[model samples]
Target: MKKLMNFKGLLLSGMMMLGMTAFAQDGASTTENYDQGFRLGFGLNGGVTTGDYFNFALGGDVRLQYDLSQRTSLTLTTGYTHLFGEDNVPDLGYIPAKAGFKAFVWGDRFYVLGEAGAGFAVTNDYNETTFLWAPGIGYANDVIDLSLRYEGANDFKTDQVALRIAYGFKL
Candidate 1:
């Protein structure tokens, strides 16, 4: 358990360092392309969960996004999810790490996204991990992002439908 926690910490730190390096490179670009380069964002979400477990989930995530073209971007995300339990179920928590792509389907502000990764669940009884994925549509601008998504795990019985709102700045 201690080793697993340490490994998770190390992985997150490494990812953050990599993201910072990318942001620094984008910031140092000499061409006008710098304005269209990479960006970093953070978000918070709260919603209800169903399918085997019924609960309220709240989560916060960080994303490093790189523009692939005028209408597309690649994103890497890491977050913590907490599910409030009811009745006999215990409170559950997860650390989700994922990579995805976002593309503007209608215009520069509206997009669709799909991400797949793993979720590490931690609890007093046992620690487990499972495959996780999400598919969603969103609207974004320079300062705000709003999205509705469905999140699920391959090994866990519960899934979630959430609406997330975020505030971000150019990096």
Candidate 2:
């Protein structure tokens, strides 16, 4: 479908941008800079939908983060989310592609993040693509990452409060 192709193109483009960024960074010898360089994570999300039509939501995502400094980073995230509908209603799902920023509000453990991008509806019941945004606070360490966020899609008229649990590692 046309929508799928568009989504694929966008996804591939974003990945290429991230890859180019990695190569553009300082060619440092030691990866001890992972503390301030590049990292990747796989996360699972579960949460309650804000609308009456759906009871719960679930998804998984891949996140790429590049730290600008000790307390700040830039991130690119892409994921799939499924909204489980109420009785007799059809479930709806979306793929989200976002770019975001994170800043540590506390020492290495606590941070706040915000993202904006598109949510492509899988079923096409809603518009094929919707504008989306998420804002949240979280905690992260060397191996584990956790966050609670509120995500909303405009044309889909859907939103949720979700928790993300993940394991992350340096490149």
Candidate 3:
């Protein structure tokens, strides 16, 4: 009888400890869905440019991101961009791909990211090789992410800038 009572006491004690730990952990938790796993996203942005040519452009970008650490990630993004205006002479539609570093600032809900890469512009004169950079900020909820980005490029001798916004879904 004494042995049985000791076993029961141990079991009850273990359950109580688990309950206390869970209560303590709940208060400091950031992303409740960390176990949801993997993230993907897309977004659209419209902004004016200031550089060699000034113009208004719209772009749509898609991102595939993986959690490298609890709040740090790596992302690969590709965007289809179009810039057209009477003043902005080049008028371009190009596909750009970037690989960058991203880190979440306020838990998993907010982030800041930057990327540097190269791109090719599809144009009437010729396919142009360009170097590009992007820095952006983002917000996320479960399953969706959004961002506003500043994009810059050096095409031959001219440099240009554009603003873009995007939305992405986790998969």
lDDT of 1 by residue, 12-94 (tens): 46434533443333333243463467888899988777655557899999888988776668989888888777788888888
RMSD of each: 11.2, 10.2, 19.0
lDDT scores in order: 0.75, 0.80, 0.64
* Best-performing candidate as measured by lDDT: 2
The TM-score, computed over Cα atoms with residue i paired to residue i, of candidate 1 is 0.77
lDDT of 2: 0.80
TM-score of each: 0.77, 0.77, 0.69
lDDT of 1: 0.75
For candidate 2, list the clashing residue pairs, or say none. none
Worst 10 residues of 3 by lDDT: 18-27
Q: TM-score of predicted model 2?
A: 0.77
Residue 114 in model 3: lDDT: 72
Clashing pairs in 3: 40-169, 41-168, 41-169, 42-167, 42-168, 43-166, 43-167, 44-165, 44-166, 45-165
